[model samples]
Target: MKTITKIFTMAAAVALFATTSLNAQTMMETDPNPAPKGMGFKVGVGINGGVFRDKSPMDYAYGADLKLQWDLTPYVAVTASGGYTKLIAKDNAVDADFIPAKGGVKVFPIKRMYLATEAGAGIAIQDGAKTNFIYSGGLGYEFGGFDAGVRYEGYVNDSASTTYFRKTGQYAVRLAYNFKL
Candidate 1:
């Protein structure tokens, strides 16, 4: 399918270009000088866990997230991640299973903690319903190239045809480290 190819295409491109190029893939790489020596234009791998609500908040849910991080600015970066969140129910439907593409601004107001806010759109697949417009916000932390962070996210449909509303969402703590090519 086109969608599958598109997704793989992006991943392969990232891996191919990233493995051969010795620059950060995210924010800091774009800057002439980066505070975090190995920051900016970074492509990192991470894992996280949190809660995912279906159409309603009453649904009990849990999830694991996997994503790639890119810091493209002296103070900003973009991350793309996908996750499978499951709802505890009879049919065992996945509460949140989506490939989210997000971008936001980040500031190192203090060491380790990053003051950040982001806006992004994603395609969410849940219980046979395909939703769009996934967004989130929050602060994060980093140490020795390892990052652990969290956020409050919202999901909606691309068009007005969406029945889903805002729900308090969380992500697993992630750590991002860099390696030399």
Candidate 2:
């Protein structure tokens, strides 16, 4: 599908950017100036858990999240993440399952602490395979190779037929480990 292609393209671009930048950094090592602490690049993976507020019948879904991240600089980074979330129900007819994919940024204010945000698209496959806009923002602290944070994420389902937004959202806490590539 076109959407899947676009997502992969974006991911390739990000990877290419990181590789080129790292190579340039290697070339710069001969210069008098050197990268500052935490100024290099890194790759990360981790797990997350949170509440997924679905539509009325299957409200308050809870699920797990998996994430991948790239730190391009001491102050800036990119993240690619995906996860499965589901709603509990007495019957299968009213249950919900969601698959979400997103890409976003992280900004570190003091090298070890960051304010992060991301926006992308996701597919809600359960009800009717509806595609929607997704976004999230939060802050976290990092020390050693570990990161911990809390973020609020939402799915926008506004279409021509509907005008209201904020129909689904989630509040989650995340912990991750990052390593330079």
Q: Against the true structure, what is each candidate's TM-score?
A: 0.54, 0.60
Q: What would you estimate as the lDDT of candidate 1?
A: 0.55
**Model 2: per-residue Cα lDDT over 1-181, one tens digit each:** 9999999999999998888845333443342212134545555566666665545333454655666666566567777878776644433444445677888888777647789898877666654445668788999988778878988877676453122233567777877787755
Local accuracy of candidate 1 as per-residue lDDT tens digits, 52-154: 4554442444555555556655455555656554433324433445556666666666655676665665556555455566567777777665667777665
- Model 2: number of backbone collisions: 0
Off by over 4 Å in 1: 1-34, 37-39, 52-74, 78-94, 126-128, 157-168, 175-181
Worst 10 residues of 1 by lDDT: 158-167
Question: In model 2, which runs have C-alpha deviations exceeding 4 angstroms?
Answer: 1-41, 52-61, 87-93, 158-166
